[model samples]
Target: MSSPLPLVFDAPKRGLPPRHLADLTLAERTEAVAALGEKPFRAKQLSRHYFARLNVDPAQMTDIPAAARERLATELMPQLLTEVRSVECDDGATRKTLWRAHDGTLLESVLMRYPDRATLCISSQAGCGMACPFCATGQGGLQRNLSTAEIVDQVRSAAAVMRDGVLPGPDGKPAPGRLSNVVFMGMGEPLANYKRVVAAVRRITDPTPSGLGISQRSVTVSTVGLAPAIRKLADEGLQVRLAVSLHTPDDELRDTLVPVNNRWSIDEVLQAAKYYIDRTSRRVSIEYALIRDVNDQPWRADLLAKRLREHLGYLVHVNVIPLNPTPGSKWDASPKDVEREFVRRVNEGGVTCTVRDTRGQEIAAACGQLAAEN
Candidate 1:
């Protein structure tokens, strides 16, 4: 067991984002519309345009009267994210967007187009508070927690781009498709921005006209061993998969690699993961970044497998990611032979494991590469 979490996790909130339609629930939208001297039905009309139709510009909302469009849209749908620039790789199959918020905060999101489905990796915070030395975002330190609207707007923008064929499909040509997966694996330790992240998840998984209508099962939330937050998320009746970024199995190295481990031991983290499985009945994912000899040792592989089996049994899957080196970082990915042996030892020890298919390294869109730099 580990000691209680320290109270110094959250960074100071610099500025609160302006209110937007994505921030409010269905009932709140109606109340706001009535308060603005508009008919209650206007709320549903505005929501359907923004959520279902992916239209945020008031000019395109022809359903509403010309006289009322500006007021209703301006008050409810203020633009939250403005595209700074986008870089693409993999024959246009992967696109990373740099966005500037209203307060000039920079954050990044990546959209990858696969043969069958598209997945968007969205950031839950402007930068990270976790202070993991190997990660680019963590090295920059946390800017602030994003508002619920800022988080959800990233998903909304990705869905719109996918629908509009902005990113090329498998054949190197533009083809419209639907976004099927969302991952909270960019820019931040999601659990540190707990409330807004949970609200954004609800808005993403809720029904059409109220949300983007994505399945809860298709979404994933990743953290670096925030044990109490893990338990809090499990009780929320959500089906989203929990991904723990446990780069190492032992506390000695993990305390330096993942700074949060100093607060919560590996045992406490896995125990919290076990509680999550008990509540959601979902297999938790263990994310291990294999960085050369630092954490790719054969003995650590066995220890990882043993620890997972003792706590989670079959309710766990391990995803070993080859470390994506950031600029000027000493960390390098483990050699292919070493990575293979590590996978072999883990599976031999009874826990199934696979290497992640890395993408967008050329444009710095790969795992742990997002710094949201200008």
Candidate 2:
């Protein structure tokens, strides 16, 4: 294995702007309200407006007394994300929003509409520390981990977008729907921002007015093979799906492709994944980005299947993603023939594998591309 990387470079820059309602648990919010000289129940009211009603405007909160409403809103509903710009493609069904944080940090989140459901891809950190060469976000390096509120508000905003019928439907007309799936596959390695990401997940899956009320099963958290973090997440008692970005089956290529691989080998990562499956009884997702003539060989596919079968057996699935080449990147998606053959080999080796339906390519949908371009 490569020598362990120095720890100084990867430690997240701590802290966020003033606390917001989404940043606190119910008990914390109650204490915050009391500290501001308001009754404890006012916290519940604020949570209902921000979470269930998805309204942050004090004026819209008619249930609260007018005087206290403004103070409460001003104190706990601080705007965390400002829209820098939004770009859309797939006939406006896919929208990517670039947001500027209070500290001038830039991050991107994508809301994609499909026939059966709407999925929002959220960022856990401002930029990625994983340093995956093919990813645009990793190119910029990690700026800072997002606050829990910063992460939760993305889902809330996207939920309102879906609820209010902003995106067009199958008939190419606006139709209201519920945002169903939330994927932590944008801009950052979620496990690198572990504490806030876990808190955000709770705020997302908890029942409203405590949270956005999205089901735990609908949430997916992806990491670039953070082995210890994977097992740590399993112990949290959450059923959210775990996705490992195992770009290659072999460590030689993976260490270059996913720099984090040097810290935790494939065996260690798979062993951690098996622990997650054993804990949650949910199938762990093995994410593989198929770069042309690189990590796309039939032998690699067979080896990936064999390793997965050996470690995880029926508790894992492979998601073969076509490489979304970043600007001026040497990496590109494999030819259809090569991708198809790769999938066939993995399936033949006894693990289920499927090519992901990639979207928003025309609009630079790959993770940090939009934020980087803007």
Candidate 3:
């Protein structure tokens, strides 16, 4: 049979059900509550539960009227996700959750508690369409883009876990009772789901009575260098960090590594990255996954550093990641010595560089692995 047609990038879309508070903007939330025959002030109280306190339980909303709590919760806070399974590793500091949505779609997100902070890696789509050959999620193909509420719910749940003292750090503390950072480098190409992703960012950064109060600076939105989208985000004037997953420096090899590079050349991607740096005054992060004998050469390292110097200037930082190999894939991480050499060359060229810590490998918590099994 012929392959089925793919999802059109620009087709008019209907979002996920409104049970999720994250899908609604502040004004929308006000209107929804007002529609429920409640006063406008109820919207502010609901916002506090969803954002500031990070709790959605009607029983805990003491400030709200006892008679009105059940009605409000039923109308505003229907559960969107059911936990499928949770895998814990790193001596219990890291936990990856596989969730089944209300529609029975499987998706994954991770919560990691560190000494200083807790971070959550959230997915933007049910599966990915990017089709990067080395990636497991790419092989599965796209299921659909997640709604804004689906994406934000991941953070809300993780934040609630941290606050409840369920996740502990090395010192056995409750990891500060708040989520410190959020990374968008999970399953999908976030920029591909542009409107929802941007909406999610606003929900995450807005102060209480509107959305979650997380600092915009603490959020990192990653993409595989969607050039036009990169430029568009720069115009947003928000301070959230931007990460460009430039797996390889040269277009000749990257064309195979990241197929999207075929449409937008490396030069165009870097130039767009420069615009982000100039506009936001925030350092752009370059994520390079080190694979054995491929894109791991010292020469490629030097070229990567040189390119950053030319296009990004001082507003760039390199995060070299050890490739987390799929079960039967031909690829594996580069040798430690080679990995160190790659870092050395990039630093010598006068750009900041470091190897990213590889975590949750045993449970397939690394990027591109979760969606593979689902």
The segments of candidate 3 whose C-alpha lies over 4 angstroms from its true place after superposition are 1-15, 173-176
- Candidate 3, residue 227: the lDDT equals 94
> On residues 26-119, what C-alpha lDDT tens digit does candidate 3 reach at each position?
7887898889898878888888888878887899999999878788888888888889889888888898999888777778899888877788
Instruction: Judge candidate 2 against the unseen true structure and give its global Cα lDDT, from 0 to 1.
Output: 0.92
Clashes of each: 0, 0, 0
Q: Quick one: ranking by TM-score, best first?
A: 2, 1, 3
Cα lDDT tens digits for candidate 2, 171-241: 88999999999999998889988999999999999999889999999999999988999999999999899
Pick the lDDT winner.
2
Question: What TM-score does candidate 3 get on C-alpha atoms?
Answer: 0.94
Q: Which regions of candidate 1 are displaced past 4 Å?
A: 1-8, 367-372
lDDT of each: 0.90, 0.92, 0.85
- Superposed on all Cα atoms, model 1 deviates from the true structure by an RMSD in Å of 1.7
In candidate 1 the C-alpha lDDT for residue 332 amounts to 95
Question: What are the RMSDs of all candidates, in order?
Answer: 1.7, 1.2, 3.2
Give the local distance difference test score of model 3. Answer: 0.85
Of 1 and 2, the candidate ahead on TM-score is 2
